[model samples]
Target chain A: MKYVNLVVIFSLLTFFACTSSDSDYQVSDIPGGYMPGDTARDFQLKNVNGKMVSLANYENAKGYIVIFTCNTCPYAAMYEERIIELHKKFADKGYPVIAINPNDESEEPGDSYDEMIVQAKEKGYRFPYVQDKTQEITKAYGATNTPHVYVLNKDRKVVYIGSIDNNARDAESADKFYVEDAIKALENNKTPEISKTKAIGCTIKWAS
Target chain B: MIKPMKNVNLVVVFSILTFAACTSSDGDYQGSGTAGKHVVGDTARDFQSEKVIKFPELQEYITTSTDDKVKVINFWATWCAPCIKELPFIDSLRYTYDPDKVEVLLVSLDFPDQLSKVNKLLQRKKLSSTVWLLDESDPNLYIDKVDPSWTGALPATLLVRNSTDQRIFLGKELTKAELETHINKLLN
Candidate 1:
């Protein structure tokens, strides 16, 4: 009788442990909100010179292309030439490409302001290479990955968010240029057929 | 009576075998500290935290979950920028929610060498949330175990409320509004 009672108690404990809680956790899915018509949030990030720059600072701009990049991501490095091209193609036409390093220097020493300067100088980045000192601007823009791109209209709202293109692992078969298409559509005053995409790159490093 | 005794002996042998098998493999984490130390490469300064759990039975340290509370599990690395940016907001969320109804667990991915840095950051920020350093070494083996599709991203968050359902967010940062909205949705 004692043995039977012990078995019963053991089974009851197992059942309770298994059924009482279903709080098994997994990694979360990407947050969503942006679409073809969403307006971009205004931001003030410190430039390489330590001056705060905001959307209002570019008063006469037609559009803005904000790219969340870093000094370390190989994928972002792959797109450096493309980024320069975009700035050259659009800055005089009223759309200026802005690059922001959102990696925390405390966690990623290579992404420090001084390193950013060296990288910009080496790559000859003509556009503003801003530093998100506290990463407030990066979070405000909903940028989750390095090389995450956001394109805004003249009124400063996010019209496009995601990768520079569909290709990152290989350049030989690189076909889609999503950011370019989005900018062209914005220039033509039409909705982009594809407004968002999944950015593939290194995860943003946060400070401990 | 002899035959019955023989049968009883067989049952006893089977039970012992079963117990041995279960206890030997289940929760028997024998892989202790083979994850390689971070060597500075061309990319950046890499710091890895120690992986050996000094206390083998530390799993018992987790408190029992309450019925009314929702637990937020955040997997982060000290070097991840978005994780750092979103942490203050997460702290703010803890303050905003009722303590009895919400719990936040911050799991650090720092190398064992950086425990001091992690502790210092927590102290500097005055974070009161429960903090734990994940002592597993092999991320490639363990990352998928955490979630098959995680892709080893930092600033990953898991929201749980007693096994019925859970939500995962893989990204760099989250705003207070975003965090609150998701928490509310999950509670409902």
Candidate 2:
């Protein structure tokens, strides 16, 4: 009986290690993170509404558009209105946009908790704009840039990762809507065809 | 049928290798299009050119395939505070390091509209190293080539030592001493 228990535990450990993409955790070397199909981790962060929220809070959510975005980045600014639109379009479909400001506030005053609230209010963000005070969430997600989006499936699998769209300057010029397309595919019970793309924006401010 | 299958496998492998090779070597993107400007044999002055490199030209740009010159390529943007702060160390690197042995390429990650602003900043700082505006639209396409470890982050620097063909990537802000230490280690 004891031997059986040890075998069961060891097999479980091996299974997890194999299932977790080595690249997602190999973030010790480079900041690139969370390949498609990796399971998402749950976190408790302070939302702009002053409520402590976690992934578990969304009981009815089919999926999530978890964006590592902030107030200071021009790239984030470029996508702010679009992000709000994404939430509006998808929130009713059980996919809501959760914006997290992971930058160290001491380094970036514009991204301070107070400023986050101000930005959310000014933009009239319908979704929860949160803060990762310890940066544990950011590091776990392997978020390297602002406006980096990770689409989570109903099973909590990261279906897609990378930028919201191709165009940074003008939305009218955007030929590819990576995030929207991914969400639509997920809604139809299909995996996103393009699972990963590069996210270009201000590097997440680390407390060096 | 067997012959075609073999060829298909080769094509797949070559595509993967080509992608890996160019990710860090995209520093060589500007090496072409200049006619006898600073040929390897020539004693070059502080090399700075205003040439614009579109995405099409980038497909052919690989500086490592050439001769012995340590290439230091930095990917920076005007909006990034750390990138702006770290520019001087790269500038100082031009004078402190052996110019004949080292070649610095400061590639600005500025957009097309920001060209005048980037040029103004370069002039204000009096940066002597050759500067190039990264004209490619999709950063995802080139950021990996810039440095596979780089998450398209600002203040990413790539150092290529010619003799041993060593390529090193630093994807964060660095002080002057840290810059010197890295280059010296590369040289040795």
Candidate 3:
């Protein structure tokens, strides 16, 4: 009986040690984050409207444009209009936008849930603007930067992961519409030519 | 019963090894780029200077003489909070060491249109280091061009010694002591 207890305790300790946040490593050093073609896990996160929103709720959705963004980051702010435009373009085509704020309130007070409500209202966000309070979904998706995007097909397989476009500085000047191209490929039942790209973005303020 | 106990001990040992490997595997996470592209020991790309420096001439600017001095290039922006917090210590590096021993370059990743914001911060900070605003427009092209390991995060630093072609890329903000240790390593 004593030996059984020891075994159980050791197993539990090891599990938590691996799962616990190790913040020292660079964002890329984070292990087991979702890559293109990998299946993404569904999540039930709270929207600014105080309702739980999950991908399962969208039965008609051919896919989802899940973005990990926050109100505080300037980079995120730059893409806010673009994100709205993304929803407007693709929502009717069966891909709805789901915006999640991954920043902790303590680290960035502007990213708090209440602030999200204000921003959503002010921006007249047509899509579900959610908050990942626990950040489990954010960690599961391995989002390092504000406005990080992951496009998942109906099968929940991530087809694209990157910035919304090549130019975060200016939307009108952006030549590469990465997310749009990916969704367009999916609509045509073809593989996206480009699956991944990177851009300079604010680091998500993780709870220390 | 005794056999099961031995198995448990073995499992524990294996788990500990796995945990240790995860913690120390920073070097193992190499960039997924082609070989010899922006990795350490290779010449780093030149920054977007205020004067719009092109290549060949820009190469001369980034590559210091084999005078054994370490060049510290820090990538930051005016909007990034942590980058602003660490600017003072990074700026102090200029005063801490003789110009012949260490050189600090502050590269602003701010958009070309936001040049005024970058200048405002520089003026307020009274930074003595040379400042350059990145002239590049698209990040997807420049991010990997800068370093394969870079995920386009702010507060990234690159320490290089031109003489030996030795370089270290730190992807996070550094304390003054930590910065000195890396510079000392290159200097020695």
Candidate 4:
């Protein structure tokens, strides 16, 4: 009887452990290890104008500043102008910023394609405000959050994966401009001092 | 004949276990709290039926509970289906646990306009758990403040036994078994 009780307890423990392990939030590590030399993957995403734009469209560009942002996240909103400015600063030098809205429209109605266009126009976005229709591109890029950024080299490989800068709440408190520093380093043919940092923003509303 | 019967029984047990595991993982118990549709950017005053607490003071409320008890702060929203489903289970938990040892705090992420509706829902459910509306407008700002690693997902939970060791669960809906296990582990 004691042995049976012990067996039952052990089985229950195993069951709980298995369940907890299965339910444990298995957040995928942002696929990293892509250095300055790796080639970037080419993807075609729909622009706010309902036009598909590919990496090849930005021909002869030195690099690409791919940012996964959305209409709602305050963090993304705060960095909107900064993103535009980054593109304006680098577009002439052959690197143009490409913005993608990865939030599912079904979950967040404001993130619908029409709303994206409206928001883009309202914000005066000069860059291509693309929509990840199936969120295939977003998932492929492993963009889990709005305002999650990836600086890909001209070769199309991810050179940096993190925030636009250090400050999301207060711009004044930002000490290290990681994105800017990475872009400058890439331009200089030198490796960025810091390659990654945790991104802060709204969770991407995937069609689960 | 007996061998065949035993094999059939084995199959039946296996199927039952599989169903239980699947349901345990994904099942949510639906409650009777239906929220009325309210457009975004609506004023806090528009929805007078729901209770709205001052947003900034939520943290203080959670942290500064005068009672010496374990606080289970559940972040939920009326729009979220899983959150609605978990309320009854949470109420059950509140009933089962000792009030002096455990306190359940249901922090609604519902818009200020929907507060009255939520309050009515709570009242209808006869839920006596200490409830508060999270008044923070922007999740991006407050989500991190709540926990730097939080992804601002609804139906998330934070179980605080004090400042030192707190368990944070980020997901939609939790089963009674899972809740019991967590509570037992923490309490023990």
Best by lDDT: 3
lDDT of 2 by residue, B70-185 (tens): 77778787777889898877877767867877778788777654544564566456565677777666776776655455667677877776466566667677777776666776
Clashing pairs in 4: A39-A157, A40-A156, A40-A157, B49-B116, B50-B115, B50-B116, B50-B117, B51-B115, B51-B116
Q: Which ranges of candidate 2 are over 4 A from the true structure?
A: A1-33, B1-48, B55-62
Q: How large a fraction of the reference contact set does each model reproduce?
A: 0.09, 0.53, 0.58, 0.04
Model 1: CAPRI class: incorrect
| Model 1, span B109-187: residue lDDT tens | 6644455456446544545566667654334334444433354456666566653444444344566777777677667
Model with the higher TM-score, candidate 1 or 2: 2
Q: Model 1, which residues run further than 4 Å from truth?
A: A1-36, B1-188
Best by TM-score: 2
Ranking by DockQ: 2, 3, 1, 4
Model 3 score (lDDT): 0.75
RMSD of 3: 18.9
| Clash total of candidate 4 | 9
Model 4 lDDT tens row, A1-208: 0112324543554565567521212332333323334565778888988788898998789888999998876557768878888988988988898999998899878789999999999988889999887987887776766788889888887788778776654466677787889889998998788766654445677785
**True-vs-predicted CA distance for residue A14, candidate 2, Å:** 26
- Report how far residue A94 has shifted in candidate 2, in Å: 0.9
Individual DockQ of the candidates? Answer: 0.05, 0.24, 0.23, 0.05
Question: On residues A30-57, what C-alpha lDDT tens digit does candidate 2 reach at each position?
Answer: 3445678889898899999999878889
- Model 4: runs farther than 4 Å from truth? A1-40, B1-96, B100-188
lDDT by residue (tens digit), candidate 3, B1-188? 00111213424433443553455432221232343133455322221223322233333545657577788888898888899998989988877888898988788777554543564466456554777666666777666545555677788887778787766677666788888888877777
